[model samples]
Target: MTSFSAAQRSRVTMLDVAERAGVSKASVSRFIGDDRALLSDAIALRIEQAIDALGYRPNQMARGLKRGRTRLIGMLVADIRNPYSIAVMHGVETACRQHGYNLVVCNTDRDDEQERQHLAALRAYNIEGLIVNTLGHHLEQLLELQREMPLVLVDRKVDALHSDLVGLDNPLAVRMALEHLEQQGYRDILLVSEVADGTSSRVERLHSFQSQVSLRKDLRGAIQETGPDLHTRLQAFLAQDGAGPKALFCANGIAALACTKALRELGCRLFEDIGLIALDDLDWYPLVGSGITALAQPTQAIGTSAFDCLLKRLRGDTSPTRSLDFAPQLLIRGSTQPL
Candidate 1:
């Protein structure tokens, strides 16, 4: 008999198991697959004994592929560092585990080239479905993927994709935020957001804010993008005397953090110089001079629902496309207090 190292033992294959059992490879396959019941007790016992003796484990990916199911779900996130993405991904992962599927997440860092690369890699893996929280810059690739598998869009919608969508009701959420600010005596408002870049959610929020501000005679509102000029812009906005006490409506968590930093840089007293209300309640919201008021999206529920939509499609669901819009809960803090 020949001796084998641990590495050699780990490389043991099905053929090795069959040779050890003194049986054919087909017999071994039958013993391990759906045809197990077809194997006689004597042959099945030999195969089992050989497998245990050799510490053999079947390749689950290969087995799954043979059954036309890899049991893997893919998720593409625009920015993984965003707290909102992290929270939502947690929910998606939990749902996947419950349903005996695995999640493969790819972060594009908001780059079109990276987005295309990730999409290509995910397609090569034959993922069962896709959850997109990206800018959808690579529309051609996305459309192709949609043809191959069901896609669920999160937080943002791609034009002409016509797939399922899971996100906050942007119009209603913006309305709620504005209503809260107005109730707190914040009449002069600035909507701070990341550059729209054709992202559907941002556009929706911006349009809603504009429409609502126009409807109210007492309220004054303007929009700003978070960038290098943000600090200078903040200074100008703060210096203006009219429009009553002012407040900042941050469009999302990333924008909230950026605007807060700009405010700090401009030496403004938090909530005293300018009030702040932001979408997406981050963990550090309460630690600021005055806690930041926020419209918190149901991230976990949204993620779970996205997966549920994908599951339905995988199970032969041919229903019309769906749009699942969730609501946000307002959490009042010192940031939106009347000054």
Candidate 2:
């Protein structure tokens, strides 16, 4: 018979699981921690069964203190105003809580100085892992942190940092958007994006658009960045006489919003005078005029995967660095219709 009451069993701990499994605390820890690969199958099964039976949960806060891990994960966001960032952050927070970790998110607002300051603040808190979504301008600080903990990059790629990456499959997404445009009988395509700002995602999308246009001899593609002059540039595109139907392909949600506003200002009919499809669908996509067709990135999945990559490293799984690229789901809406 167990010495403790049923009440004690209800408040099960790692010690309870270890005792019930007839194993040492170290062995039980190895089973739950990142070093489970070191344990034999039989031992692993025993520990799992014991945990299940006792309903034991690891007190990560207490355990982290003992192991010098704070069970805190840090995320650096470039533009919190961007819908994509907000959606991804929600996913990260959900996954962190599920895995007994807490998230400390810092929004740099796409500023380099703020990025540096946030990185320093995250380090001060001794975060066990980091998931970054900003342009990694401060290389020295990033490199220093990577030495002590795991880092996973999302959406943007930092040069010379060989860490796990969790992001959308940009090439595939670009291809999908182009193909949809072509199918809808759009020949002249204007790919509008925000300024590259050294962001890998934007750069890749731009490059992909150029490449796609090159391969499709019948199609002509032009590039424009959203800025104060977006209205002027878009007006010129609308006036230009092209071979066939002209459509605006927004590289992401921000670009879509900007281009849509420009079209509104020009008093151009949506999808009647110009067709449009954008990347990274926001909730307001359907509410827009005739709805905006989109190649929607699995933002939540990308965020959750980034945290999972960091968690694996924190748990001591020192295997090859992983790159998780999720595919987009094409949501065909009225915006991509032919004239």
Candidate 3:
């Protein structure tokens, strides 16, 4: 009796399948490989039987090395803590799984250096594409990456990079807030933002508020820009008698919460001392003293659109780079009206 070495017994190859099935090695190889054109039904059945009998599992790493395409996508989000980012990621992950692709996620914490490092790591993995929820600071680096791989921008866009973008209509969202407030007889409105430099969403919201207020002479001078220390500054502004804007329009959920805390500390009564309206309907909006009124962006729609845009790019549909903007819906609550 002859004894087979441990290495020989452990190894499983196409030749073994061919020997078991009584067919050529080339026939087994063609059947197991992705190229279906080279396989016939009878040979394919025999190859499948041989594979099951031998318990053969092909080496995915070797297959990837040979094909040079890994069917993986990299998703870079500015902040994973933000609810909006998580919603968008849900859409991306769902789309990837449906198409036999896998996603690798990286959170940049809105840091430029971190963004660059993540991009490098994703490249090393040879990701088939990218879905970027950007910080809007790394324009040159992102533009260069776009030239090398297909990328879709979500929520925020880099100015220099011509890529598909999916986000809420910022100007319209702000307009909705303003209109709701106006109808409720609150004319002295203030628009508060965290960053002084202003993002696309912030700038667009401010501009829209100003444009709409300009038409009505009774409206206050203009919307106020609160500094980074919004809570403290807002409290100080409200302390002075008739000094600050009577109504507040928060740019997003973050600023809205800060404003809420300031109001609570100041012992301010909702719709009596001041009116409040915010963008992005938050989870805690309804739980507040009086529910906060807001212009709600369609979070699911934004995510789904982004995923669809990425899929189109991957399918070689090189149509014009598109921007898909979802309209905002106003949720009326006690915050914007008198008790």
Tens-place lDDT per residue, model 1, 221-302, is 9999999899999899999875798999999989999988888888889899888999999999989887999899999999
* lDDT of each residue in 7-94, candidate 2, tens digit only: 7655987788888888888999998888999988988898999887776767666767778978799999998988999999999999
Q: What is the C-alpha lDDT of each candidate?
A: 0.91, 0.89, 0.77
Best by lDDT: 1
Looking at model 3, the pairs that clash are none
Runs in model 3 deviating more than 4 A are 1-62, 196-198, 221-228, 240-245
Please provide TM-scores, in order, for all candidate models, with all chains considered together: 0.91, 0.81, 0.80
Candidate 2 global TM-score: 0.81
lDDT tens digits, residues 270-319, model 3?
65788888888888998986788888888877876777788788788889
lDDT of model number 1: 0.91
Model 2: how far residue 293 lies from native, Å: 0.5
Winner on TM-score between 2 and 3 is: 2
Q: Which candidate would rank higher by lDDT, 2 or 3?
A: 2
TM-score (C-alpha) between model 1 and the true structure = 0.91
When summed lDDT is taken over every stretch of 10 residues in candidate 3, the lowest stretch is 1-10
